[model samples]
Target chain A: MVKNRQWRLISFPSGRPEASNWELVETEAPEVAPGHLLVKALYLDVAPYMRGRISPQPNYAAGVGLGEVMVGGAVGRVLESRSPGFAAGDLVVADFAFGWQEYAVLSPGDVRRIDPALAPLPYWLDLFGLNGLTAYFALFDAGAMKAGDTVLISAAAGSVGQIAGQLAKLAGCRAVAVTSSAEKAAWCREAGYDAVIDYRAAADLPAAVAEACPQGVDLFLDNTAGPIHDAAMQNLALDARVVVVGTASLADTFGAPDTGPRFLRQILVARATVCGFLFSDYAARHEAGRARLRRWYEAGRIHSKFDIAEGIASMPDAFLRLLTSRNLGKQLVRLEGD
Target chain B: MVKNRQWRLISFPSGRPEASNWELVETEAPEVAPGHLLVKALYLDVAPYMRGRISPQPNYAAGVGLGEVMVGGAVGRVLESRSPGFAAGDLVVADFAFGWQEYAVLSPGDVRRIDPALAPLPYWLDLFGLNGLTAYFALFDAGAMKAGDTVLISAAAGSVGQIAGQLAKLAGCRAVAVTSSAEKAAWCREAGYDAVIDYRAAADLPAAVAEACPQGVDLFLDNTAGPIHDAAMQNLALDARVVVVGTASLADTFGAPDTGPRFLRQILVARATVCGFLFSDYAARHEAGRARLRRWYEAGRIHSKFDIAEGIASMPDAFLRLLTSRNLGKQLVRLEGD
Candidate 1:
């Protein structure tokens, strides 16, 4: 019997998560059923969205129950298989339901096969996974980004933001990045963003955005939806499209309602559209999105960056750092060597 | 020389407009210049949109300058014409730039000719004009409303609300109306709304909306964007569309920023879209919208109700009443016999 190490939610987080909220323990792995496979976790992704799952209240997805494994996405290798579709040594990626565990018994259909040759194992958690798919659909499908359009992305150095900025540039649109620090801003520029707004340095974000995008933003990919969203709303061009992706800044205030500048007048005046996009809704077309991402990766037109924490024990800390914007790119915990 | 009476804004209103904010004066009418026609105003429209124009800050349209005629739409008869497009005794409609006045010399190109026989002369300012066009494009175009969709219209006894409720019903969608009083609620029922929520009676608006639309709202035509908008945001269905048409309740709070519950989380979770629609953006397709409206009117599938205040002198009072929700349906000042 294999010993499995798991991080479970001991308590729901009131604001920002703490170490006390989680309990790391070791237990024997469950027996693999006839149609299931035993998988050894390689790399686990800790994202801003995980903050919602640990909250006491329910979100779009189910909340993690007390004593349950802390939910997350993980790249794993099929150690043993009882299912006809999979065999030992095959690499696969499981979505959030897989949780933060060293070993898991998953059904064949629960995980998607990935080629290690595409990029890297951690990249499957970044570029070829939820992050990349989110950027792809939010920009092209929801925002309806077009050539000559000015695209503004908030949290510009995050996993999705980096890819979105590069994608916007590739689409022949003017890409602007809003980052919290000078370091992230420089990274965004390297990623092919035409302009960068250091939101931390600027006294007035709307004015800064207006200065960067003189014609005003035609498409906005909003990740931090507090002041950044309010600023973007102020400078929207006629018929602007705002894609609501994430709200990392408000992670601490999830239990209470957040109040900000009203957007109705600006929206009405500019004839703009603000849409909330959840990537999972486009599950049927994910392969299409992945194929395009692969081509872009092969062409070296896009790149992925990972801020990885070594070992399974660092999962909670990595997630906490991600929530506070301490990480530069996709936050991940490396569980096992390639 | 004819005496031209005018209602001019003497000061920008701080909150709800008062008679003291405007001045009624008599001036000698200018001679009809070549290429211009003398228009004797027959009916002047007083709408919620007019509140935006009288504000200190510029809205989608320019604010009415102090000492200038209060900007509004008006239907008039051409007394004399020197331009090829217009002739003496022809009826015409002029948009908001025309200003509130009994007589004015305007370029023939400044106004569009209208047929009184198509409907009543006042209907040109109601169902056949801006109000009708707003409801049409907002529901059908921006909202992309489908049959079996549930629509929630705020301020449902108002002009646009009444028409929108009926339009949603005609489209085979469930129409729920949120009004301020029992009387307006009864009127909305008569207009074919499936459900009515008197917002004044509900202690918890979101709960009331959830109770009214058990399945959640697919399309929201929001007129008052304070608490009602907050409630609607809380109960959005997946891929729901919110059309921000007006903010009548916030008419007094124009000087200061209005803060309410932030909608980004709700918007993101539901994968919904909120759009601010200005009818003028669809100017190229106004005729198509009008043709559809005319057909509906002819087929008795649509109807228009007006609360008429006699004479141009009552324009200020009519507009004030409309702003306070004191007037029902489309508020208008009948300057002359129809």
Candidate 2:
């Protein structure tokens, strides 16, 4: 009988997600049903949004239930298959709840086939996976980014931000990166952003952002909302668009995320749009993102970065580090040894 | 020699305008300069927007300066013409400064020739003038109202709200009017609103609005911003448009207007737009509104409601009445001799 390890939410988190909230559990693998494939996870992504899933607060999605496997996207290999579409040794990405786990048995329809010749396994979790898909929809679909427009991205060193910067460059836009550290600024510049501003170093962020973007930002991708978002609202040009993706700033202050200044009047005066997007809402466009990313990856036009931690037991720690901005790109935990 | 009387601002008011701030200055008849036409004022339209002009705070336009005629729009008869377009005895609408006067001189281009047969002098200042034009653009142009959409108008008993209600109805929309009292509610309903919610009676406005519009509110014309705007933000439908036109709530409040609860997330989550628009911004469309209103007025498809007070000296009291929610429709003043 095959054995698998999975992380279950032991308790709801009080402030930041703690080790006690997550408990690793072992279970016997289910008998392979027809049209189902068994996946052995290579890399599991730890996104900042997952923090909201562990907290006991009203959020866009329900928090992970106590004693349930922590939900996430994973890049894996098809170890065994009872489905016609997949076979042994095939690589795939799936929106499986088997994250922080060793192996999972999922339906063939749940697994999205990936190209190994184009990119490595972690790229699936970074570029071709949720991060890349989110950046694509938020920037192009939601923000309606155009050529020559100035695009400011918060958390510019993060997985989604890196991809968005490259995409903006490809679209002939002036990409401005707002990062918390100087190292992240360098990372963003290397990724082809026109300008980078260290949000941490500035006393007056709105003035700093305005100085960086003299014409003001036309499009804003807000992942980390705090002082940076408040400044972005003030420095927006006419008909600006702000895409609200994540609230990672909530982690810094425990439960009370800093309430930024009211920007409705500014939005009205500028004729700008501020829109929030849940990734799952665009399921129909997944194929479009997949096709585009595949082309970009095949052409070596985009880069993917992963900050991986080995072992299933370190999943909670890795997620906590992700909340504290310890990881460089996509934060992930690999269960290769277990 | 003809004697001309004009109401000029002697001092700027700290809050609501008072009679002492203005002085009725008598001067010799203004000579028609090159490209300018002489006009004898017939009717001056007193609008709520004038309150914004009297304030010291910076707005979309410059505030009323000391020792200048109070800015307003009026219907007048051309007493003399130096400009090529205007003829003597021609009835026209002028979007110019100092409408609260006996006689004034204006550039020919500033005044739009009106059809007295289609819509009388009062109609041009009411339904076909700035008030009606503002409601049209704010509702249809800026808000992007579509047929069968649900619309909610705050301060529904006011001049702009009443016309907006009829316009929304004419466009085959489900229009809900929110007013101060039961009497105003009845008037709004009689004015052809599909639903009327009395703010004083409804404790839970969002629930009441939801009950009235089972589907959701697709468009919101905001004049009063306080609890009503907050409630409306909570229940906006997918892709809703909230147009912030005026803030009557600010009129009663002392000191700077409170920032209030931030609804930026609500705007984002609903993929909605909250836009602020000024009627003067679309001065080009004034003629179009006049033409449409002319046809409607001739056909009796639309009507104008005016709360007329005799004597231009009563302007201060009329303005106070407008601030206190005592006036039902367009507030105007006529010279006592007329």
Candidate 3:
């Protein structure tokens, strides 16, 4: 029997996560039941929203239980299948709740076969997967983006950011990206965005976004919602649409994001719309979103970037880094080298 | 020459209007110009939104200037006309921009011919006018009300509130009206609402709203923007729509409405939408809105309650009452004896 090491919740985090909140343990290999596929975990995706999940909320999906494996999304290789489709080395995307483990057992319904031709393995976890689908639907469906509209994307160099920026350009929109670093700005600029604003360097972000876009922002895709949201709120044009996808700003415990005063008034005066969305709600449309996203990727119209941390054992640290915005793009941990 | 006693703005109030801010003066009517009509003001409309116009903003028209008759919408009789289509004794809606005055001089473009058959003189200032159109479009067009959906209207006894509540009910929605008093609650119940919540007495409004509407609120017509807005944010169902029309909360003067903790999370989790709109933007559609509202009134489906304050000299005190939420339904000033 193979021994599996898993990251379990030791305690709830109060603020920034530390190693103490998680405990690593060895467990017996998960049994492959009938109609179930055993996946040897190859990569674990780390995201900012995971922090909100660590603390239990009655409204949301079940959070990480004490001594239970930490919850996440993962890409793995199907080592054993008990169903009609027997596979030995098929790359698959698993929706198994907890991903920071060496192996997991997933029902066929919870897993999707990945086409290896779609860039690389990390690309599936980043661009053509949940992250990319989120940015696409949130901007297009919820935001109601039109071609030639000025788009402002927050957290624009992250995994979702790289693809969103390129997608906006592909759709003939003028994309203005906001990133935390100069390097990420350079990355966003190279991604074909019309303008890239280094949010950290720009003391007056509203002025910078206005100056960079020239025309006011028509659609704003917000991933990090602190000062960036406040700034974008002021600079948005009449009838603007804002999609709130993630709140990296709230990762710090005991303190909320520092959204400045006059935020709602900004929404009022501009006749703008602010909507929040979850990717799971769009699950039925996922395959369609992915199909369109795949076409774009195949046509070289979009790009995916990942900041892979090296080991399953370092999952806790990687997750902590993800919460702190330390990872440039989609934060992930590779169990083994590609 | 006709002797006209008018209420003039002696000074613009920095905060709230006081008796000293207005002055009553008698003047001799001037001769009508080449394209101007002289109107004998009949009914002057008093609305909460007019407070915003008086305060120095880029509104429908300029601010009510100091030492000038207060700007308002009024129903009047054209006493003398220099324009071809206008005739003496014709009932008309005029924005001479001086409704608080006994007489007004208006250009042809600023006046609309009124059909007295469909509505009485007061109807021109209430249901078939700006107040009614504001309620109709804000609920139907901006809020996008659907049949069988649940609607929660704040300030349900005020001018727009009374009209919007009836509109929502007519649209086949489960309309819940939030009012500040027992009298208003009884009025809302008689106004054909499914539920009425007395916000003044309720300790936990969100819980109260949820208890009243077990399935949850689908659309919120927000006029009071403080705790009611926060509660509406919490009680919103997935993809719920919130339409913000007025800020009647006492806290509106300070800054942006304060959304309590977990408000943004509630919005994100519910996948809800919050949008603000001004009725004046739909000026082109005003006639269409009026026609539909007129049909509702003639069919005996719509009801309007007026707190008529007699005389143009009472305009200052009348405005003070409107601002303090002391008036129910449409607050009107009778400029002439009926």
Question: Pick by DockQ: which candidate is best?
Answer: 1
- Best candidate (score: TM-score): 1
Candidate 1, B180-237: lDDT as tens digits: 7777687778767899999898999989999999998888887777789888876777
Candidate 1's TM-score:
0.77
Model 2 chain A scores worst on lDDT over the 10 consecutive residues at: A271-280
Interface RMSD of the predictions, in order shown? 33.9, 35.6, 34.4
Q: Tens-digit lDDT track for model 3 on B1-338?
A: 88776667777556555556666677887789998899876665455555554565333236777777766667788999999989999888853354566678888878778878755565555555554555666666567789988999987776667777777776789999888778768877877788999988999987988887787777777776667766775566655676666655532242223344223322332344534332233445534544443353345443323345654334335434533334432344443231
Predicted complex 1: CAPRI docking category = incorrect
Give the least accurate 10-residue stretch of model 3 chain A, judged by summed lDDT. Answer: A254-263
lDDT of 2: 0.64
- TM accuracy, model 2: 0.71
Per-residue CA lDDT of model 2 for A227-248, tens digit only, reads 7777786666655676666555
* Total colliding residue pairs, candidate 1: 0
Residue-by-residue lDDT tens digits, candidate 3, A1-338:
98777777788767666666776687887899999889876666555545666765332246778888877666678889997775878888764353566678888877777777634455445554455556556666667778988999987766556667766876789999998777667767766789989977998887998798777778877766667876776565655676666555644532333234223332332334434333234435434544443353346433323345553234335434433224433333333221
Two-chain DockQ for each candidate model: 0.07, 0.04, 0.06
Clashing pairs in 1: none
**Highest lDDT, which number?**
1
Q: How well is candidate 3 docked (DockQ)?
A: 0.06
Off by over 4 Å in 3: A95-98, A253-338, B57-62, B65-68, B95-98, B250-338
lDDT of each: 0.68, 0.64, 0.62
